[model samples]
Target: MSSFKSYFSIIQVLLLFGYTGFFSCGAGAQQMASEVKEVKAPKLLFLNYTISKDTNGTYRATFINKVLTEGRLKDKTQRQPLSDAGDIVCIQYNDKNDVLDRSYIKNPLQPIVEYVNDDGNLEKRQLNLNSAQIAIKLQLQEATSSVRLFLIDASGNASTDLITTSIR
Candidate 1:
């Protein structure tokens, strides 16, 4: 009877701590989110950085298309897939969509671009010819505060909406 009572007591203690931690963690996350400013895809900005600063204060940037890796945007649930031979454009813009820099990826899957890896090393990478999506890197003159990217297919189907990659 004592062992059974001990087991029940331990379970009760675990449940108490687990539920308490879970609820508190959620509330804390919510509060932190509320404190932060609204931004479009903030995590993406940090991941695929649109800007970088060298040690000499010379800031440079690149539009590395990590999302369009496989050459096509497809959803199994969707009836039609957005993929073809056309172009993908990365447009850097100001707050009011003033175009700052425009980079195009034509014949995207057949590039000999000097890709800068995460370690800041330049590497020669090439995309296969049979790629469905546009795959290339575009070096920018300088980092901008925001970017809007879109793709247009040969069949005249464009990206449904603007892909805003911003740090504002």
Candidate 2:
């Protein structure tokens, strides 16, 4: 009977801690969302994107991003599991206005761990992946509003891929 009582007490304590932690985490996430609503770095980060263009000259850019958040909440030595929260931001422009400076990069964001060729194995994508892909959609003369995607790095550098889509 005494052992059962101890077990019950332990369970109650765990529940209390669990509830407290849950609320704390919820508040933290809400705070983060309010602080930065969109990503602003590392231009041309993309897994893949499809562009649908038409006449009339409308333009829009949409961004889909996953941020890497690391926390030492579990064991001090071991980090917590990753959090996968998707942030979607969109900007729009019409050919009638909003001219932007543009630059292009090919195969910009590499997200591969290793490659095996005639050589046994080659490690790859090291130091990269500071962020996930930002899906951008361009529509010209079609009246699309999505404009740009960006991210702020730890050093507070705003890395961005800029595009100019408007009438002209």
Question: Which candidate should be chosen as best, given TM-score against the real structure?
Answer: 1
**TM-score of every candidate:** 0.30, 0.25
lDDT of 2 by residue, 1-168 (tens): 999999999999999999999999999999998998664322321223322223532222333332222222222221112112212222444444453322122222333466665778675643333233334322222343334433223343334333322222
**lDDT score, candidate 1, position 9:** 100
Q: Lowest summed lDDT over 10 consecutive residues: which window, candidate 2?
A: 78-87
Off by over 4 Å in 1: 1-84, 107-143, 155-162
Evaluate all candidate structures by whole-model CA lDDT and list the values in order. 0.51, 0.38
lDDT of 1 by residue, 1-168 (tens): 999999999999999999999999999999998999864331222214233334653323344444312123222222223345444556667666677755544434355668889999999976544333333333322345666555655665544233566544
